[model samples]
Target: MRVCLIASGSKGNAVYLQSGESRILVDAGFAARELSRRLELIGVEAQSLDAVFVSHEHGDHCRGLGPLARRYQLPVYMNPETFQALPSLGRVADLHHFDTGSAFTCRDLHVETIPLTHDAARPVAYVVETREGRIGIATDLGIATRLVRERLKGCRVLILEANHDETMLRDGPYPWPLKHRIRGNHGHLSNGDCADLLGDLLWDGLETVFLAHMSETNNRAELALECVQRVLEKQNLCRPQIVVGRQSESSICVSL
Candidate 1:
């Protein structure tokens, strides 16, 4: 299985996962044209995508669904709430309504959607298992739940969010109310929040970890890494190969 970061952040969120003859996308946040170009760089064509699994109605996660799926004739799956929020497309439908809880099979790939905490109607984090191993992709969430920690347990690869630096967000230019929303339990995960969550995770099989969905004004890769690195060091866990996902571009495919 090959996992590619198409994009990640408050700006946009997308991931391309391929295993054998199957290829699926976790989100379609980028513009249709830009998404096609990014996929091509990773040796995939828009028409080759098997399906799209949406997490919610938030534009950062679903903005391009209508345009991209329609243009390429791809199937889309999501929860009923998320489905209702999108523009109707011939092949798009709700995953929960389909009776495929957080877990479903799309071709040879097995995907599990872990429920998420956010302001959206219904949101989720995704864990994809393939012939290669298990990989979890989670972001745009605030505090980690017991379910999330369990679902992501032992993932060979992890794409988790380290969305902000609390201090930077508080003292930086954004207003207090906006800052409260971000720091709220229902909002994004801060660097410290991310570190604390990873500390409690069982990391035996974990190989790689990428800090995704960071705020441009409030975070730097170095800070995100420092937080995780400190926690990993204290726990005596395997120093998982770590990378930071950028908002403007996709990250290189890391071994999962």
Candidate 2:
């Protein structure tokens, strides 16, 4: 399995996954033109995607879903509520709605949907199983529950949320209401929260970790990396390859 974080930040987010003959996109937050450009940079074509799996109804996760799916005639998978809440996604040729917590297959890949705490409609995280091993993608959630830790176990590569640094967020310029929302139960994960989650998720087979969905204003890549690194050091665990997902570009493709 090969995974590339196409883009990840408050502005937009997408991920590309390939295993065997299947090429899947986890989200399509950018405009069609921009998404196509990013895919091209990573040597993938927009029309070549097998399917699109939406995590929620938030614009940063699904803004381009309608156009992308319509253009490519791609199948879109999401929970029922999310599909209902999505803004007028025009004439999606193939819509497959799965219940949250159900497991489904797309070609050779098996996907398990785990419900997440987020403001968007029926938000969920995906744990994808490939021939090599499992790859987990869980961003945009505020807290990591026990179920999240369990589902992420044994994953070879994990794309987990490291949305902000608490101190920065508390002192940042966002209005009080917006700041409160970001730090609330359904908001986003902080660096400290991410580090703690990483400590719980560490295992022998966890080969790579990508810290994703970072806040542009409230967090620095270096700070996020440092927090996770500190946790690894405290636990005396072997350091895994860590990549910071960027807003403007695709992350280097990682293979398992």
Best by TM-score: 2
lDDT tens digits by residue: candidate 2, 1-256: 8899999999999999999979999999999889999999989989999999999989899889999999889999999899889657778879998999999988998999999988888899999998998999999886798898888888889999999999999999999999999999899999999999989889878889999999999999999999999888877566789999999899999987
**Cα RMSD (Å) per model?**
2.1, 0.9
TM-score of each: 0.93, 0.98
What is residue 87's positional error in candidate 2, in angstroms? 3.2
The per-residue C-alpha lDDT of model 1 at residue 165 equals: 92
lDDT of 1 by residue, 29-148 (tens): 888888999888888899998898887778888778888887877778787776766654335432334332457877887788888887777788888888888988888776798888
Alpha carbon lDDT at 236, candidate 1: 60
